[model samples]
Target: MKAKVFKYKSDGNTVVASYMELEPYAKNVYLSLSRKNEDGNEDDDCFHVVCRIENVYFSSGQYSRRFLKGEDCREEAATYCRNWIADTLQSAERGAFVNLISVRVFEALGLDTTSLVQAREEYKRIQEQKRREQKEKEAEERRVQEEQHQWLLNEQKRKFLDGERITGEMFLEITGRDGFDIHIRTKGTFNRHVRGIDRNGTVSFRKIKGCRTPDFTGCHKAVSAYLAFITEKEGK
Candidate 1:
């Protein structure tokens, strides 16, 4: 559909010109067409078609300016202006101009906005689904971590109860507790006695008081296993 053309005065009524104005299709949006001339001459290059929405302006540019300069220019400008409005509306439907165009504008123009509304709803649905999936993924990760932690604790308890041979490092870790004193005799020698005094002042030895062994490494491993068993029992 073409916009209605009308004549108006320009530059303090010294120049006479005709311009086309379309019906307001959206709130605060206006479309108009005028001759691209300084003195409103008929020999201008082409018509100037523009659409203004709020503070922003969209021009038809060189394409609309190519229309022939004659009485037919008004109809051609109106046709191009209508196409420009349709393009703007299509952009809004795709969410490009979502914040600029409103439902009231579609109603004012008597255009159905079902596709635009559906597009927005679909976008929201996709985002909500993604959030739900992310939450589920995080919950599954936490569940696996907790299961691994429990498995490690169970394995440690089993080894302690079985009296398995532990390293000298393990012995130090167990005796490093607060208020515990580790006593090492015959340092770096074959005959070594490794023991601990607990916070209650009780001595820790492997199956005997002041446990001793000819092999220093053997003594340390035996003491470590004994301390680990005692700590596990205390914890239980």
Candidate 2:
């Protein structure tokens, strides 16, 4: 697999200038270069190259090797690190376990592994923040929908209380009826039925059928207005 290179800033004197991951099994193998001297002084003309596979230093307890400031010197150190990663991958393929690490070994070396730990914690925090934001957004949308439904119910009830002329459909909505149907007869008569189910599963049916009154009267005007409203609503 192709290697992925990255960098990390640490609290120690050295900064991880270059980091690489070659393969899944070889992910524990780390390589980095720092530009600080042994006495914690910044040295522009020197680079400290360190290579390790999970606490076992390839340089045998010497954490790093010094390289002078030059393109040739930098490339030489990078080539060695890449070769070391390739060797580690071959070793893993031969049934070598590369995923295990010993805390005691790490403590003995006094290696600073805080950069990787902090990176994982930062990623987890970001994911949790996104989850919280999504939940809040969904809750706000439900609240707005409930408010709109309540406003519509109040408006329909006000029209009924104020003695205003309302369609049969409006009456059904205001009373929370589940369904309704209207049938107009040929002799200028009509049948209107409103149906609903109560909390105890009891069916309630209201039928106002065959009213042979004038078109301007109570039930007649309401049914006529409901038919007109439905025709306009359906574009029929």
Give the per-residue lDDT digits (tens) of candidate 2, residues 1-236. 22323222353322232333222212334333333466764443232234444444332111233323434754554565556545544444453433222222233356443433444455557778989999999999999998887787677646644554444445556433322343333112222432322212222345447754324243444444554564575595
| CA displacement after TM-score superposition, residue 125 of candidate 1 (Å) | 1.1
Model 1 earns a TM-score of 0.33
Q: Pick the candidate with the highest TM-score.
A: 1
Ten residues in a row with the worst lDDT in model 1? 185-194
Q: What would the per-residue lDDT of candidate 1 be over residues 1-236, giving only the tens digit for each residue?
A: 24322222443222222345543433333344444566655455343344443323343333233344346655655565556546756765665533213343443456687765665666677778999999999999999998886665555445544664333333344434323444444223312233432222233434555654334543444455555656775799
Please report, in order, the local distance difference test score of every candidate based on alpha carbons: 0.46, 0.42
* Positional deviation of residue 172's Cα in model 2 after best superposition, in angstroms: 5.8
Instruction: Give the runs in model 2 whose Cα sits over 4 Å from its true position.
Output: 1-112, 163-236
RMSD of each: 18.0, 19.1
lDDT of 2 at 65: 37
How far in Å is the alpha carbon of 32 misplaced in model 2? 30
Count backbone clashes in candidate 1. 0
